[model samples]
Target chain A: MKTIWFHLMPYPELPDDFTDEHRSVWVDIDPALFDARVGHRMYNEYIDELEFAASVGFDGVGINEHHSNAYGLMPSPNLIAAALARTCPDAALVVLGDSVALYNPPIRVAEEFAMLDCISGGRLVAGFPVGTPMDTLYAYGNNPATLRERYHEGIELILKAWTADDVFSFNGKYSKLRYVNCWPRPAQKPHPPIWIPGGGSVDTWEWCARVGYSYLYLSYFGYKAALKTMQGFWKCVEDAGRPANPFQAGFAQFFGVADSEAEAIELYREPAEYFFNRCLHVYPGFADPPGYKTLNTVRNGAEGMVERAAREANERAAQAAKKAERKAAQQSFSAASHMSFEQMVEKGYVIVGNPDQVAEKTVEMAKQLRIGHVMSLCHFGNMSRDLAMHNTELMATKVLPQIRHLWDDEWEDEWWPQPLPASDRVMPSPRPTVSR
Target chain B: MIDLAQWKAGSLEIWREGEGRTVGYLHGMVCAPGRQPFVTELASRGFEVVAPSLPGYSRTAPSDDIRNIHDWVFALSEIIDVAGLAGAPMVASSTGAMLALELAAVRPEAFSSLVLVAPLGLWRDDLPVADPFSTTLSGQRALLTKDPTTTALFFEDHESGDALVDATIQRYTARTATASLVWPLPEFGLSQRIHRVSCPVTLVWGSDDQIIDPSYADSFAACLRDVRGRHVVNGAGHLAEWDDPSAVASIAASALN
Candidate 1:
């Protein structure tokens, strides 16, 4: 199993009364609340953390994009990826990733990803996300009805730009280009390993399966809640007649480990609360826009194909009752914002224990979910640098070694990044001292 | 209630009744044209009311070609011509009023006269239009009218009990159509083109309109080429026709006459 240290890089200085006073944490989040000097310090500290994670034997280091958001400071993950490509020499540069539909032409993504792959010596895992409603529809003002269409077209355009041998002319509904040629081709022959980080959209699952891309379920809710979505994805993979390779899927989980169970809880409780309560306190209005979810999703149960199939198994009279229960279960993540820490623990929102125990539980959950990759968010919310480092060091030194040998012998891990050896890697010459 | 009338662009569910001169009606942001009480009131007031549910507002499938405001204007103009109410006196409301004015600006003789209620074609940075799409359904109901109860026609389950999904899709398609034209902000440069409308326009506003301020009436009046009159009905909100259909019908009848 491969582990990636993922950071949301949230602002740490929101006042105690932020959730009460502000209407939302995104889109129309107050500009006055963000302090530039603090941001400058946070950016440097966050990058240092990612670099530290890479040095400590983590397989990959990751960052993501979010716009007009207080929780995620990264509006451009590519900039962070560029910085990491030079600094984190031993780690995969995972940008999980750019919202392709948000770009005007979307060739911007192809060019940038190719550039990152080249700079990182082919250790790049490209992530394409359709994006949240707040980021895509409200903040960027993309049409909700047409966002998915643009995303589909944008991916098509980007793939052709990367793989096509000759320059081509492209005509599309959302974008048109007279000349379509990417200057710096990716170091990876076909393209970088494509990972789609998605929410529970049925169409997204089927698309990822059909195209042979690894599906990364980036959910805040823990493995228990994620089981349903991952099950639906595996069903799609089965229906597509593809090999049920564990490496074809990835799951993100927030974990806290220490010397003892009590110590782990004490250390992680505040940051966990901060993340669930304050960071996730988005306005309900920004959650779902008209046409954001497809008509098919609306017609089927909100949980998508799995729920529909489950409903069909039950007697017709009992389906409605089961649906009402499912609806409450879906709200469990948002309800975490108001829940007690013990409640969160019992419900599996965050996995907390000693290093050995955490390792044991993680392996168990990974096997049950049939996934090989874990994007571990060890540092979350307003967790301090010292605490974050301790957590990372513990997870790297003790936990990772225990889980490392899980699927290595049974199946080939094909989705991991393949970096060029140091002998073949290119390094720019140092700048010469200027003479007067 | 008449079945949907087919046109070149798509099928439109229309409300057509009564006899005498034709009076075309276009609905506001809340519901389709026929769903509102004013359509029936106007039809009963001794005139033929030709009110077609704009494309995507009813069961008719939205065309992929209709992507922007220009396409909306062209499609709406074509609907009026196909429905055979091209030269009739028209009464339009809110979002419909915005489209009607756009059509009138480009094709002067499309309507003999126009009665526009709380049209949404202008923007004031300080007095911004309340975003109907960004709030809860109940909150949106409160913005659309002074009394939230009047919005049951929009939120209440349809008569077909098992067709809940179908009703949700209807509302979503209607919202998609409106948001395509008015989202982020409702202004689409109609202030610059208001001078081109040759037909006489009578403006109406709900005194308590929260979506677009009642004061915006003066803003529209200042730019229009020919403003016959401006009237504000008392005890009403943004969808004034829903609040007091009799008063809106009476005002519209007087304007048409």
Candidate 2:
């Protein structure tokens, strides 16, 4: 099995009374709360952790996009991925990805991604996400009615721009380029392996299946809750008559492995609580706009639609229920946040315990879902840099080596990043290693 | 009566009433209010009103041919042409008025005159219009009308079975089509082309209209080359006709005459 370390890079110093004092942590979040000086240090610390994970023998290190939110500070994942490409040579510099729809011409994405692949010596995993409506529709000013249409159009334009051999005049519904030429074609022939990060939309599932791309579901809502979606994707693959190669799917989970269960709980409990309770306190209204969800998705009661359907139920009870949930952090933290250490472990929201326990639970999770890639989120919320470093080393030394051989003999990973041929590879200066 | 008009790949619902000189009626962000008391009053005033579904709205499945604002103008112009209102005086409300303003600007030969009510086309930085796309039901209801009771003219609840799905799809698709025009912001540069509208234009707004403020009435009038004057109906909101049927219908009657 291929395991990667994904970082969300959350801002952890929010006031204790954040739930009461703040309306939300996204889109309309108070800019006054963010300090540039603190951000400078936090960013460096985050990049260091990602590089550290790559150097310590993890197969890959990942980063993703979020916008106008404190939950994930990296709005532009490309900027961070470029820095990672320069610093970390060996690991898959998984840009778990850019919201391809946000770019105007979207060829800009093709251009930038091509440059990143070249810089990384062909070690880029292009992640195309439709993006949350909060980022795409409201924050980015995309019309929700035509959001998907524009997104599909953007993807079409990008794929064509990347692989087209000749410069041609292209006319798209959203973008029109008189001379279509993508300078500096990708290092990987055709393009980098496309990974789609979705929130369980059936359209996204069938799309990824049909296109032979990996559907990486990154959820703060742990593996137990995520089972519904994982099953849905597996079903799509089965229905499509495609092989259920574990490499075709990836799932992200929070973890803290230690020498003992007590030590693991003590180390991870705070950050786990912080991520679920504070980082995820987005305003319900900002998450969905009119026509943001497709009618099919809405009818099917997909992951994103439940919140919208509840808010728009036209019943006073439903409105009050939504309002109550939004206002009270305690209500959600207990039910889904699983803040208590035992609850977190029981729910499989966070795999925190001794190395044996962590590895056992993680392997079981992968085998049950038939997920080939397990994306571990080791650094989350506001764990101190020193502790984050310790967590990375422990997970690398004690946990990863134990489970790296699970599915290797049976299934080939076609979705993993292909290393450049030795002649073209530009290896970064190897970081001095701590004894493995 | 409301009936489906199948043409090409799109199926449009056309509502026609009364008998006389045809009035090319344009609906706003909401579905056709059917033969509501306001539409009924307008019909009783002796005029055949033709309100066809805008492209990709109501029962009219969206077409690939219609993409942007210009595409919308072209498709709507085709509908107007097919309805045989080649040079009819038009009555349009809310976003419908926004489209009518564009059409009249593009092809002034097709429209004889225009009565735009609570039209939302002009952008105001200081007096930014309330966005209906993101708001909840109650919040949207508040912005659109002063009295929630007036919303009965738009939302016919207590629907059962087939009628229930029909009502839900009606509201869902209406907003979907509306967001294509007014979302993010209602500023599609109609101000730059409002001067090109050759026909005499009358702007009517509700005094208490919360959606598109009444102050925008003058802002829209300021950009037009020709103006037949502006009127504000008391005790009305953005859907001024629904709130004050008599006042809006009377003003529209005078403008059309």
Candidate 3:
């Protein structure tokens, strides 16, 4: 199994009264609350943790994009990726990634991804997430109905820009570029590995399976809640007649490790509570715009599909009961809001234990979920640098080494970034193109 | 009570009522008629009201493919034909008024006269329109109707099981469809083209419209070539018809006459 150290990089100094006084922690967060001096220090410390993760032999160091968000300081993951490329030499810089649909001429995505791949000596696991409704529709002003359409077309345009042998003229629904050519093509031939971090969309699952890309279920809800989704993704892959390699599936889990179970709870409880309660305190209005979930998803996915099936079979009596149950299950992730340490442990929102126990539990969960790649957020919420570093070292040295050998002899892990050999790598230089 | 009419483009339901001279009533963001006295008052004044529930508002399928104002204009124009009001006077409210202004600007001959109530299209950097989507349910209700009693009288939540789910879906789908028109910001550059409307236009606004300020009515009235000036209804909010239906009817009747 390949282990990744993921950083959310939350601002830790929100006052105790922030929850009561503030309506949301995201888009409408008060700019006055941010301290620029603190921001500079946080950036350095966050990068240090990511670089440290790479140094300790973790397979990947990941950063993601979120705009106007206090929880995620990375509005632009490529900036962090570029910086990490210079320092963290071998580990995959998972730029998981720029919201492609947010760009006007999506050639911008191709250009930036190419730049990162070139600079990182081809160590880029390209992640294309159809960004959260908060980031895409509300914050950036992309139309909710057209966001996924733009995302679909943007990825198409980007792929053509990167791999096309000659310069091409492309006219798409959302983007029109007269000259679709990317200078400084990715060092990875064709492109680097593509991983889609889905919010459990059926369209996303099928697309990831149909094309040979890995699917990362970026769920805050633990394995018990995410089991159906992971099973659905594997089912889609099987239905597509593709091999069900565990490497093609990636899952994120919050894990805390200490010398003992009690210590682990004590060490990570504050940050866990802070994350579930404060970081995720988004306005319900911003969560789902009316047309944000597509008709296909509404009509074909789990709820819609099941409702239709039950109705067809004259099982209307059973449908309503199912719906009420489903609604409760969806809200289970909110256990983080004022969660007790025992609640976090029992529910598996965060796997907490001693080093050997955490390793044992992680391997068990990974085997059950059948995911070969685990993006472990060992440093979460407002976890301090010292605690985060200790957690990172423990996860890297204790947990990773024990389980990294899982499925290593059975399957070729093709979905991860292939860092080019130092002798073979050639970095591209910037040049001004003369316009005719 | 109005009868629900079905159309073929999708299994969409439209509301058609009253008789005499045809009046194309483009409803506000919602199509709730619970105790709303304007349609009856219009009928008493002898004007036939063809108030469409619109696609997505009445258990009808909205064209999921509509991504912008251009598509909306076409879909609404098709509805005008479906309602058989190719060239009738149009009374549009809120979001519908924005659609009407755009349609009238594009076609010029679509409406004989336009009665636009609290139309939501123009954007002012200095005087920003408050976002309705960002608010909670009670907060939005407070913005739409001036009297809290009026909201309770109409949208009484005494539903359970399937009825509750049905009502919830209907309300949400309508709002979702409206988001396509007004999502992040309500302005779709109708200010640039409102000048092109050829029909005589009357702007109606609630004096205390918290959702959209009544002051914007004058701003919009100024842009049209043949505007009949702004009419500010007293003691009303955004949905002025619900607050003071007879007053709205009086102004619309007097203007139409």
Note the residue pairs that clash in candidate 1.
none
Per-residue lDDT over B168-244 for candidate 1, one digit per residue giving the tens place of the 0 to 100 score: 77887887777777776777788888788889999999999989999999899999988998999998999998888
DockQ of each: 0.50, 0.64, 0.39
lDDT (C-alpha) at residue B205 in model 3: 93
Better of 1 and 3 by TM-score: 1
In model 1, the Cα lDDT at residue A53 comes to: 95
Fraction of reference contacts reproduced per prediction? Answer: 0.49, 0.67, 0.55
Model 1's DockQ score: 0.50
lDDT of model 2, residue A80 = 94
Best by lDDT: 1
TM-score of chain A of 1: 0.90
Docking class of 1: medium
On lDDT, the stronger of 1 and 2 is 1
How well does each candidate superpose onto the true structure, as a TM-score?
Answer: 0.92, 0.91, 0.87
Winner on DockQ between 2 and 3 is: 2
Task: Return the lDDT, model 1, position B179.
Answer: 76
Tens-place lDDT per residue, model 3, A233-330, is 89999999999899999888999999999999899999987876667666654665666676546554343221222222223223434654667555
